[model samples]
Structures are given as C-alpha cells and as structure tokens.
Target: MIGLVMAGGKGTRMDAKEEKLLLQYKKPVVIHVIDALKSSNCFSKIMAATSDNSPNTQSLLQNNGIETIKTKGDGYVSDLNAALSYLHELTLVVSGDLPLLDGGIIKDLVASYDGGAWQSFLVTKKFLDDMNMMLEFSVNHDNKECYYTGISIVDPKKISSTNTIKETYRIIDDKRLALNLNTKRDYDLLKGA
Candidate 1:
C-alpha cells in the first residue's frame, strides 16, 4: 500500500497569511502528518497530494525527501480523484492537518480494515462529545453512530468515471482520529489539548 497525504486546499477557513499546513505547532502540521505515516511503517511509499496554488507546501515536502503529486486545487473530491488516478494500487489517504495523528492509529486502521471494502476511519459520537467537537453528519454503521475522521483506505482502481465509489468499511471510536485542524478554532482547540 502507498500513503497519500492531501494538502492542496487553500484553507480559506483558516484565514491565515500562510497556508494552514505550514503554520507551526512544534512543527508544521503537514510534517507531523508525514511523520505519522512514516512511523506507521504500513506503506511502501508516501507522497503528498498538492496543487499549483500550494507551491510552498509542495516545496517543503520535496525538501524533506517526500514526493508530491500536483492536483487540480479545485475541491477535496477533485484533488483526491486526481491523486487516485496517479496511484495504481491501494492507497491510504490522510488529511494533512491532522497533527495529533500517530502511528498507532494508522496501524489500527490498517489492521482493522477488511480488504474488500473502501475503508474509512471514524470517530464515535461519544468520542466527539468528549472532545467537545461540534457534531457534523453521523452515519449509522453496525447500529452505532460515527463520524468521518478524514482518513481512508481507497483502491485507486475502484474509482469510477464520475469519481465516486460504492461500498465502505468503518473503523470506529479512536479519539486520536478526531483532531482535524481545519479552522483557526480547531487549531486553538488542538493547542489547548
């Protein structure tokens, strides 16, 4: 399996002078993500999915010896689809802003995944409540409530012409999976943690 870290978004929500991924938190958020992926020891290779608008992010990753693939910079799905097209095998997709992500969480996600399904890591409703994160959409899986954690195990070959996929697997209730830094508020919360 290969690892793909998606970091191409403009991060308008962050309203920062610099890219959100480049903002420091002990280290840049994207670097923390890359370290997590590397420490997991799960993937044969790891690459960043970036875009033209994010030259600094791309350059930073390349300087750190991580390969990067340019994407459309349109939207999450579009960039993800572009990255998928470049990858010909099963790829583990991770959000670049998830600084709290660690190797153990990635290991658990990979180990729990059933090879047949398009697996996504999810945090249980209780986990979100404990973290004081606003509840977004929830799905009833195995009769339990869970939310997307922005991590997925996708098979590039399974992507359809319209950039959609069917069938899903959920790995649930990992608190470490809840720390996704999208806005300044989320970053503040992470800092407080």
Candidate 2:
C-alpha cells in the first residue's frame, strides 16, 4: 500500500496568510497528518502531494524527510488525478488539514477495505453533528446519513480521470474523523477539543 497526503490547497476558507497545512496545532497540521499515516503502519511508502503555490509546505515535508509529488494546484480533482497517475496498486489518500486524525482511524479504514471497489471512503454523520462540523452535501449510505472523513483508499490504476470514479462508503461513528480544519471557527473548536 502507498499513502499520499493531499496538501496542495490554497485554503481560501482559512483566511490566513500562510498555508493551512502549515498552521500550528500541537504541531503543523501537515505534520500531524503525516505522523498519523506513519503510525498506521499501513503503507509501504508515504508521500505528500503538493503544488508550486505551496513551496513552504513542500519544503517542510522534505525537511521532515518525507517525499512529495508536485501537482498543478489547479483543483482538488485535478491535483488528485496528477498524483494518482504516478502511483500504482492500492493508494490511501488523506487530507492534510485533519489535525485530529490518528493511526487507529487510518488502520480501521485500511482493514475494512475489501479490494473490490474502485474507491472507498470512511464516513460519518453523527460524528460531524457532534463536532458541529457542517458539510454542504450529505450522503446516504446503508440507510444512514453521513459525510466523508477525508480519508480514502483507491486503486490508483483504476483511476482514469477523476477521483470520483466508482465509489463505496464505509460508515463509521468515529468522532476523530470529523475534525477537519477549514476555518478559524473550526480551528478554535479543535483547540478547545
């Protein structure tokens, strides 16, 4: 298995001068995500997908001895496609702004993967409600409403154009997956938690 952390976003919603992935929590948000992926022991290799706009982010990852893949910074789907094109076999993709992410959640997602689906995500609705995180879209799976946790497993070889290839969902009640740092309000809530 290969792991890729998506850290190329400009984070306009964060309203910060620096990249959101560089924002300090217990540590840099990107570092927290990288640590989680490393601790999960689920990947043979772990790399970060970055873009030209985020030189600092790329430098930080490299300074920490992490490898990075440079993308166009065009958009999430486009960047994802660029990164996917280079990887083969099962690839685990995670958002870099999830400070609350940890090994257990990643482990669970990896273990639940059946290897039959083109793409799979770990999702939750109750956890989002409990954390007061709002998603513009809601998904219904297994008769339950849920939101994506920003963690997914995909067969990179199966990806032709976009990340939205045939997909599957794994509903989980894990609250750790709900704390996505998108805004100042979210950062405040995360700090409080």
Candidate 3:
C-alpha cells in the first residue's frame, strides 16, 4: 500500500497569500497530514502529490525528506489521475488541509475497508453542524446528506478503466475527518479553537 497526500490545489477559496498546504497550525498543514500517514504505519511508502500551483509545498516536502510527485497543476480529479498513473497499487489518498487527522483515524479508515474500486469516507451533515463547521459540498449517501472527508482508498489501476466505478461509502462521525479547511471561515474557526 502507498500513501499519497494531495497537496496541489490552488486553494482559491482559502484566499491566503501563502499556499494553504504551507500554512501552519502547529506545523505546516501538509506536514500534519504526512505525519499522520507516517504514524499510521499502514503504507510501505508515502508521497506528496504536488503541482505548479504549490511549488513551495513541493520544495518543503522534498527538503524534509519526503518523496513528491509533480502533476500539471490541473483540477483535483485531473491532478489525482496524473499521480495515480505512477502509483500502481492500493493508494490511500488524503487531502493536505485535514490538519486534525491522526494515525488512529487513518488506521480505522483502512481497517473498515472491505473491498471496492474506491472507498470514500464521509461525515453526516448533522455531525458538521454540531461541530459548527462549514459545509462546502455534499452528496446523498444512503438517502442522507453527507460531506466527503477527502480521505479514500483506491486501486489506481481500476480508476482508468471507466468513469463509473463501484464506490463504497463509509460514514464516520469523527471530527478529525470532518474539519476540512477550505475557506477563510474554516481557517478562522480552527485558529480560534
């Protein structure tokens, strides 16, 4: 298994002068994610997926002794696909903005996987509302509104075969996975905490 941290986004919604992945809470946001992935002890190797949108982030990861793969600064799915092209096995994909994520949460997510082309982790809308977190987007999961946690496990080989793949949705009630810092409000909320 491999771990791939998706850190190439432009983060226009964050409205930050610096790249969002480089923004620090305790340390750089992406570092927290990389640390969690390392702590989980789940992957044989981990790499940060970067792009022209986040050159500083790429350099920082490289300087810190982490492997990195460069994409074309394309959109989310496109950039992920570009990285997946190089990763030929089960890859754990995580967003760089999930600062609160921890090793236990990641281990639990991986343990919950049974089998599928893709397994997405989500949190119910009610969970975020109770946490007073902002909801950027959502989808109908099991007839309930849920927010995608930006954590998933996928086989890169299976992705290119078709646009439609069997997806297994796992709803987790953990705040660590729910706090996606996508906007100024989300950042301020974390800062104020």
Candidate 4:
C-alpha cells in the first residue's frame, strides 16, 4: 500500500503569511498528521506530493526522510493527479493541514473493508445522524477523477472516472471529517484546547 499526501494548496483561509501545512502547533503542521499515519503501519510506501510554489516545503519534508513527489501546478487536484499518475497500487491520501487526526482511526477504516470499493470507511464521530463524514481523502489514484475519504480502504479496481470529486463537499450529519486548520481561528481553537 502507498500513502499519498497532497500539500499544494495556497491555504487562503489562513490569514497568516505561513502556509497552513507549514504552521507549527507543538510540532509543524504536516508532521503531526504524518506521524500519525506513520504509526498506522498500514502503508508500505509513504510519500508526499507537492508542487513548485513551495520549494522549501519539499526540503522540509525531505529532511525528515519522507519521500517527496514534486510536480508542476497548484490545486490539491493537480498535486493529487501528479501523485496518482504514478502509483498504481492502492493509496491512502492525506491532506497537509490535518493535525488532530489519529492514525488508529485510519487503521480501523482499513479493517472495516469487506473488499468492495470501500471509498469510505472509518470511525468518525456522528454529529447528526447516519450520514458519515468521510474526512480523509483517499485518491482513487488509478483514475485522477475519483477521490474519497475520511479514512478508507480503497480497492483501486473500483475507482473509475465515473465518480465525482467534490472540492468541498460538506456533511452536515458529521462535520468531524474536516478538522482543517485553514484559518487563524481554527488554529487558535485547536491550540487553545
């Protein structure tokens, strides 16, 4: 299994000059999520996918020994395509700004798979009802158009271009999927706790 990280967003919501993924919260932004994923022990190949806009970001992640896939564009989708184009195997995709995420949550997701195209699986706190908030983004890498998450055990065979990729599809029933630190307010809310 491979782990694909999308780290190319400009993080416009974050008012600070620093990028959201680079922001430090006890540790750096990406590190916390990376560390959690590392702890999951589910992925054999772990790497980050970034673009040219953030040159130092690659070096920073590389310094920690994580392999980097540098590409040529913006948009998480662009970085997603760059990473997925090469990885034929199933991959667990994570965004750069997730810090409060837990690796065990992902492990549980993989375990829940019954071998279908489980584009979404995992333990997400139910805020409203039966609708599960797929928080994590798993790239249906085989096809650039397919993407799903909140923790998922992917069957690459089932991922096809027929599936829709939403830019910011929210789940009112379970808002827990997006614990994104995209703004100073988000950062403060997390750090304050």
Report RMSD (Å) for each prediction in the order shown. 1.8, 1.8, 1.1, 6.7
Task: Give the per-residue lDDT of model 1 (tens digit) for 140-168.
Answer: 77777888878889876776664345658
Q: For residues 124-174, what per-residue lDDT tens digits would candidate 3 score against the true structure?
A: 998989999966668899898998989889987777553787888999988
Per-model TM-score, in order, reads 0.92, 0.92, 0.96, 0.73
How does residue 7 of candidate 4 score in lDDT?
Answer: 71
**Candidate 1 TM-score, true structure as reference:** 0.92
**Candidate 4 at 143: error in angstroms?**
28
Which structure among the candidates has the greatest TM-score? 3
Model 3 regions lying over 4 Å from their true place: none
* CA deviation > 4 Å runs, candidate 2: 161-164
The C-alpha stretches of model 4 lying farther than 4 A from their native spots are 114-118, 121-177
TM accuracy, model 2:
0.92
Task: Give the per-residue lDDT of model 4 (tens digit) for 118-143.
Answer: 35432323421233222334333323
- The number of residue pairs in model 2 that clash at the backbone is 0
Ranking by TM-score: 3, 2, 1, 4
> Residue 135's C-alpha lDDT in candidate 4?
31
State the C-alpha lDDT per candidate.
0.84, 0.82, 0.89, 0.61
Provide the lowest-lDDT 10-residue window in model 2. Answer: 116-125
Question: Of the candidates numbered 2 and 4, which has the greater TM-score value?
Answer: 2
